[model samples]
Target: MSDVVLREPAHRVSPRAVPYWRLSAAIGDAIVAIAAVVAYVVVPGMPGWTIVLVLLVVAAAVAHVVLMPRIRYRVHRWEVTDTAVHTRSGWIGRESRIAPISRVQTVDSRQGALMRPFGLASITVTTASAAGPITVDCLDADTAREVVARLTAITAATEDDAT
Candidate 1:
């Protein structure tokens, strides 16, 4: 078998993605904070140390809410070339994927309820790899559509069975 090498993708996600990621992180952090508060309130006669723990949790949540989005914005990137699609994503731990055009099976785009407000979308490219589909998140909606169309056309033109 040949060795596989990874390289950085050439394009960054939409600038608007930063706010979208911030909002997403904020929502999840809010849920965690609320749960911690509720647990602290509902559990009476809790140890004093538990209060410290709750405070620590809230603090961590706040930090994640504020910092993660910016980190992710810097980390996330994607590129589509004539032969392959490359992507880099995640904040805490980075991931990179490359899918050759000949191996592409399908391309799909999605806009969730939260994404609609931000005019953001995600594109998923199914390939013949065992690692599962490659997804590019927080793209501008129109860009996502264009990417999907382009990938579809490219894959359609290929002679492979995508096996």
Candidate 2:
């Protein structure tokens, strides 16, 4: 019922996030590349056109692995203000979400196996919104913990029932 004007968040994710993203992308790409190779080898007397297609797929995968991380690093950002938490994310298309402090229900931090090697974590803020929780990914582990703690304090201090 209300118009929400959105703006960019104030802080970029950790610089280490770039490499973390790159490594993640590379792992996926590697799997794709391997599948392509297996297909080529398993199919006996494969057509020349099929070989060309496989090479194209491999090339595209390589390009995605190389480019996506840098683009994501530039686009992902977050800011926690006295009244709200805001986030911007996505590599190809952008998404921005904001949760008022009074509406925050829970704040959690987590690190996946892949993220731990890079000392990175993600923070999820559960809010009383139909759209679902908002997550700021690839923060430094300590920063993520601090953010969770700060949000807990802010939301606890608010008088709202967080419904």
lDDT tens digits by residue: candidate 2, 2-114: 79966789999999999998888889889998899899999899987888888988998899988999999989999998899999999999999988998898888999999
Residue 116, model 2: lDDT of 97
Residue 70 lDDT in candidate 2: 94
Per-model TM-score on C-alpha atoms:
0.94, 0.93
| Predicted candidate 1 versus true structure: per-residue lDDT over 54-153, tens digit per residue | 8999999989988988999899999998799999999889898988999998888999999999999999999899999999998999999999989888
Top candidate when judged by TM-score against the true structure: 1
For candidate 1, report its TM-score.
Answer: 0.94
Cα error of candidate 2 at position 4, Å: 10
- Each model's lDDT: 0.90, 0.92
Error of 1 at 73 (Å): 0.7
User: What is every candidate's alpha-carbon RMSD to the true fold?
Assistant: 2.1, 2.2
Residue 5 in candidate 1, Cα distance off native in Å:
7.6
Candidate 2 pairs with clashing backbones: none
